[model samples]
Target: MSLSIGLVVHASRRGVFEEAVEPVSGVSLKWVTYGHERDIRPHVQSLVDGHALDGLLVGAVPYRACRDVLPRTLPVAVTRNSALDLALALGQAQARGWQAVPVSIDTFDHEVVCEVTESLHLDRTRVTCLPYADDQSVDEICAFHRRSLHDGDGYVITARTAVLRQSRGDLRVLNGSPTPSSIRSELRELLLRIRSERAGAAGFAAGVFCVSRHGCPGDPERSRMDLLHLLRATPELTDAWIENRGRRGVVVLGRRTLFERLSRDWLVAPVLDRAQESLNVPVSAGFGVGSSARTSVVLAERAAVRAESENRPCGYLMEDSGLVLGPIGPGGLGGPGGPGGRSAGQWTGPPTARPHREQGDRMRELARTVGLSPATLSRLAAIEHDVAGRAVTPSELADAMAVTDPSGRRLVRKLHAHGLVTSEGWAQTHRKGRPTGLYRLAIVAALTGSADGHALETV
Candidate 1:
């Protein structure tokens, strides 16, 4: 059967998005414009009374005021197509620490789920297409119970939950709503338990079912290079405060005032020096350093929140998060010359001190822990993958590390430090500006090497 979509929009609204609901070929649209509240309710009821729409799509984009007015008889699809599911799933994933399992609904293309999974860059193995079960009734739910315990594979089934619950004749129904950010974390927990057989004392459980009112937060996006720069600059920062309860991105840590004197803007210049030379979009950051004793998600959450709230729009934080952590310390981690005390080659202080603050030594451990070198990790930018989705061009590598050229002096220095390259001209200047003299790596591993293998240079 062909699908027809009806749009209820406001008189002032224009160019509404329908690609999410209408198929490329199968769906057609009809519209009704409402100048006020009275005009909408009757039209909505009229449509339902006449059975004019196979699917009702409503939202804030154009005429979203009608969303609440739509009748329940027809399958009402919200304008933000599957946003609720995505949010709930993402929240649940983060909360429960489950790995996102992208599943395809049988027969009909579950396009919404597919698009979301791709955008989220979920693992292909976790996503699959299963035969559609027409028996979407109480009977179908009973069958699902058996499937859950036999092999607790993370599955994304597109079926009504109330019906699925009714079908499970004897199994207990665990009900809840997952937040948006927690989905990734929840999936992680699920995968860990499955791999290690770390099932809890709640034995004989058939399976788990989560239904969320809010959808997934579009992506794990870190705006600009601000967060990355902040992380690299604050070498002493560590993880603290933890929010592993039932959410993903909510952790509190001991606060460190980054700018007790030198404000945020002034701090960004040298911090993202290399990256700014590459990407046109300037960035800023917010991060602190603590001991590497307890890897908590709290620090990451706090840093991220601060980056988003206090810093600029594109600002962000890449704190130790869960990667590096430690105990309560003496200075509270941020004071006059705390973690990111050394300002690149140029030093500013009461008494003259060396630029070499041994910050790289602490950073080396983080790079290695993530299975890469600090230099390699330092150059992480979103470059175009090769024709076959592999290989990083010299230019691409440079951009990741915020450099202008691959063989540039800065790149050469990073490569040399990691034993990936050798330099011929190493010039030192008494001037307090930028370093000069160009060089090259011993061998270019630009295309052949894995991104995970190399650590990014300090942003």
Candidate 2:
């Protein structure tokens, strides 16, 4: 089926997006105009109420304003300003003998502006940067622009279309014009996410579980009813059906996407975990994904067995190939790992020894959070150790991982997707080709039992 997307843009910027969607097939764009950038939530809501949109593409200003207000489950993409954008505007001004001019920017990252200036080899001190915070009023923004002008600043740049209208002086609206290629790229990325979600919804997943009634004894029938009640508490399990609820175990069938959501631990676990605590019992769940019902059920049973062997209160997943993954179920004990698990008979990672200690357990937990395999976690650990407290060049990472440049780039991109790494900056060996990307691990600092009283790690 063709996907229908809604493009929420300012009235003035609609032409570029209209042109970008002309060449693409199997997708349609509905351009919805908003009078002001901040007043976009209502317009988007109206579009959603009237049309069955598969996704949304919005301008940068409106996207930031409406991000927290709109439903996050709805797929949305926003345009971004590139270094080239700044250079283009600056290049035009430079031709007229304009130099040492203060520039004002709104709705763009300050760090990015600095990086762009440094990358282009522009004199940093000559241009005084004025960036707008989200809470700044229109009047305040205009006042700053006026002050810059009164102070003998040569130029004023802004992303908001309305800001330019308020200025009496000939102010340059830093259009940060959305290129056709960039808009197409954002649309393609959103489409891929939508397709993945749809596939997960259609796929099958099974859960085999047993309620432990050790200290607090209760009737078998009552326990079964309680378990059913707990499962019903979560809306994700609404479509789930109980296959069996006998003395052997309880088996439930549902969409694999629901399993993935519940497996996140923070999402649907608290309801079940809290119920178990109140009932003075423990629940173990084994989740399985497979092509056929019989396969899923068998894998679920094996996963339950694995959970029991590990002495875990939560459940596990047993791959068809006899590999075990998880401590997934209740009480926040969920995690991800399975070194032997192969997808389509391919080795996703090189073999490594499983960690049994605290650091190893922590690494495995972080890996699960980001949906990476245990093998990748091991590789990350090695790379982090090799370059302690330093960023790794893309070429260095590619060499260390023993993969081609493209494969290495994909791996780094995945890490960035999970916010475990970021582009530190760009570096130039000689002013020849494009500058290489310098990447540094993004550390999440939390209180730990370390001697320094803080442990820095990537999740």
Candidate 3:
């Protein structure tokens, strides 16, 4: 599918961006041009409201002006003048017989100015630079250029169109806007980000529905069949493939976007509540998104286990990118108890006595014993549950935790020191590299007060 992109630029620089984007294929551009920064917000708002844009490319001035109006989820790239742009402007000035020394520059970073000057063998001490600030005004920029001119500087260079236009009659102002190459680079990067986001939204998604044993005391096979029938009857899940998973679980397979919409961006899944109420039993639903069906199903099963741990009719969503969403229950839609409203490790139960609350406290205590934060411990526990007592390499652990390989190695070392992990034999997963050491995680055992009964004290 061709992507729609929004471009916000000053009138003076619109031509440059237009020419640069003209040759790009599979993209349709929506332009929002303004003569001044103050006039950009409404135009940007109109563009956004009128177009279903895949991404946006804007300059720093327009970005600062309309950032509050931009949608939080929209992919945006802020283009800035690079060091090469500064060097090119300087080369043009020198060719016109303008002195490079004793010149004032604005909107560019001090480091960029220093690099250009040093490379050109110019006197750094003679150059004055005013770096860009979010709250800076064009009038203030113009005042700085006037002051520099009065102080005997040869010329002034500015990246703001307003400052350049207002001071051109009196002061020798050079255009410091980014070159076409710089803008094209930013546009290409933004396009790639947009495409990646689209691909992820279309990826494989799996949902696991497990009946709570305590809530429904009956034959496991019957409960699984009931759950499957409930999901098959759900209108929102009509497009999904529903089937029996295990002894007491049902699985639903569909695209990631389907689940995202039904769950309201992974914040809440009211269908879960309806299923629980209709079946007169607590049902835990877990949703997962990944690149492949097996990975998505594994993640979905793990998330289902997490929801079951709550011991209530709730739901959780897990992504291959290491994002965990909820314990989405009653009062979740548009309420403060929605997915991002609470910490990942926090229980949704009342403040008083509850099984989930007690379980949380035990986990927190175990985290303290291991000198790790409760949040970190919660993630580690999830990893341990996902692996199901199997040995894991540091690289695999790193992927599960969404951390660097070095950080994963350090985590393994820490867990080994605390007796929460044990070393297993090495395995060669790749042909070229040496065999990676394997370790089995015992965090779940420690949390349950069963880790060898020595290294980890019972909570």
- For lDDT, the strongest prediction is 3
Task: Please give the range of 10 consecutive residues that has the lowest summed lDDT in model 1.
Answer: 204-213
Q: Write the per-residue lDDT of candidate 2 for residues 167-233, one digit (tens) a residue.
A: 6355654554556777777677777767765664577878877665443367655676676766766
RMSD of 3: 14.3
Give Cα-based local distance difference scores for all models. Answer: 0.35, 0.60, 0.74
Models ranked on lDDT: 3, 2, 1
Please say which candidate is ahead in TM-score: 1 or 3.
3
**In candidate 3, which residue ranges exceed 4 Å CA deviation?**
38-55, 65-75, 93-103, 110-127, 146-150, 169-172, 212-222, 278-280, 330-459
User: Number of clashes in every candidate structure?
Assistant: 66, 0, 0
Q: Between which residue pairs do clashes occur in model 3?
A: none
TM-score of each: 0.20, 0.54, 0.63
- For 1-459, candidate 3 gives per-residue lDDT tens digits of 788999998887889998888778899889998986778999999998998988889887788789888886677777776778889888878988998877889987654675577778888767888877777888898888777768655888888888888888888888989988888887887787667657877889999988887868677678678778878887878899888887889999999888867776555666665555456656788888877888899989988988899887677766665556566553232224553244455333322223233454555444433435555767887777777779998889999989987667667755664567887866889997445668899887776676432121111
Indicate which candidate wins on TM-score: 3
Better of 1 and 3 by lDDT: 3
Error of model 2, residue 112, in angstroms: 1.8
